[model samples]
Target: MNFTRINGLAFAFSAIKYIRYNQDFTKTTATKTTDPRPWLGLDGLVLALVCLLFLILATGDGSGNESDARLVLTTRRRRVQRRLRILSSVPSALIVFLLGLILCFIRDPTIFSDIKLGPSRFHVLKITWDDFKVGFVRGAVPQIPLSVLNSVIAVCKLSGDLFPGTELSATKVSVSVGVMNLVGCWFGAMPVCHGAGGLAGQYRFGGRSGLSVVFLGLGKLVLGLLFGNSFVRILSSFPVGILGVLLLFAGIELAMASRDMNSKEESFVMLVCAAVSLTGSSAALGFGCGIVLYLVLKLREMDFSGFPFFRSKSEPTAEDESLINP
Candidate 1:
């Protein structure tokens, strides 16, 4: 099949994998569905929705404060246009998108289900709201206009002084990687969250996908050295529709890869999570849903002892024991 067709099919499957199931399954069922290959469509849909939401918010006409932002954007139209011009290029998207693609493909322990389909290792991290210290101290208070840019510049200068040589260390590599990841995550930058994907996928790390992420890092390094700002400027110009297409495909591939959550309960939960994520932020939605689910099960008089993540459910199992609610 053509790549587009494959992408669409994958997205559909992923949605199936991620949606809310509204019920639980027998232990046998969960085991039977753990392969994780059928959920690609869901991932594609989720990411596509994320990008689309951002584009709608950025481009849509809004109230006074927003109009003022647009006015500022228009006042700087040439600069924005210049940026858009560069972003529209194929190579730029390839370079940027490739960063994400490589991460998806090369991450350790495989974030997706199919071992043959992506990196040898994959990981999924759950960030709870309670994990934060919930305090603002010193110069760190959520965005205050141009302070972020200044801070970044300060770091850049410090980095140069700290290294003071042509050589790169693990720390330097991590610093550069982190900066790229942040840039990609914000202001239309992508391919920055390499973390487990790059590290686990690399040589002797039991990674099959390491080569892909390595190439991406290397590509960025080359761009930094050879093309530099001009190359970056060009990459910044890609259209929303094009990125939508890419995100759509990427999400599908990822969701399809997460086929292990195949129980009716898991699938339903995924759908609910995706919808919530699409409508709101994923973290908020995930946490809210988790709380509700916990409560609902408790209300139904289901013993917390049998449920996953409960204090009672984690004891070492005997050979005769199975993952049942009984």
Candidate 2:
């Protein structure tokens, strides 16, 4: 499968950062808020247990070789593969989500007290010059490069890798993301962007075509229409352990995409980027570093056989390699 090693690492780091945000150990307590404490906690252990159960369920079919095109399957084998595919199409996340709701209901029914169906809350236009300046500096400035790399570039690249014939352009994705935020912000929605991790997760879960996204959009629309603020209770009460399991699998699946790097230099670049992203908590920094490292490598490999300006035009280049292999 065609993949970018750096993109895979970015997905994994993003997942880890998201998972950490949800875990109890990462919470802001009165005293522990400022301290960098260990990540081990009761919730972490519970999450691990839930993850193990889900992992078993996910791999129970033991059909890892489904992607091995070299193997010619018998009719019976094909039947089994078809059956597994059908079963996999049934979203396991729904089951986990419902289970979490049930558990919450049983443990404390008061959590459902806020489940009154109604319209969603919307924000009135209240932007001031100061707010805009502060938001631009604190939020937009840092997010620009990250969004460009992860949302536009990474997503477009992954879409091509996952769907060979499908060609997604960064410009299209960028425009889509911008339009989405412009409309969504008025409805009090969080700023959103298309992400490589999200694309990888969808593909891992058997969402192969545009129809899958259409169905998902329809489902969300229905839910919003019917429940509105009521759904917030379900989300708030949902089991963190189960959520952790979902994120854990997503991160692993995304990380596995890096396996196709196949070259030491590519792997080295990816690892350096991932490490910096994780440690510095800045995707922009990692991306900048990766670009610099890639350029350095290319410079080292430049043909010095001729004078700098007289290099052979026929020499193989990285772009040519990617085009041939991709």
Instruction: Name the top lDDT candidate.
Output: 2
Give the per-residue lDDT digits (tens) of candidate 1, residues 1-326: 11112222334433344331211223545322333322233224444445444433332221112123444455487676555444332243344355444434443323233222222232344434442234223222442211222223222332233224522244555567557754543333333432211221121112234375577678667666664344433343322223444444334433333334546665555555455544424334443574576467558776667556776645567643654534
| lDDT of candidate 2 at residue 21, scale 0 to 100 | 48
lDDT value for model 1 = 0.38
Candidates' TM-scores? 0.34, 0.75
Cα deviation of 55 in candidate 1 (Å)? Answer: 23
Weakest 10 consecutive residues, lDDT, candidate 1?
A: 196-205
Cα deviation of 218, candidate 2, in Å: 1.8
Error of 1 at 67 (Å): 57
The runs of at least 3 residues in candidate 2 whose Cα sits more than 4 Å from the true structure, single-residue gaps closed, are: 1-51, 59-89, 121-123, 258-262, 303-326
Question: Which has the greatest TM-score?
Answer: 2
At residue 212, give the lDDT of candidate 1.
55
Clashing pairs in 2: none
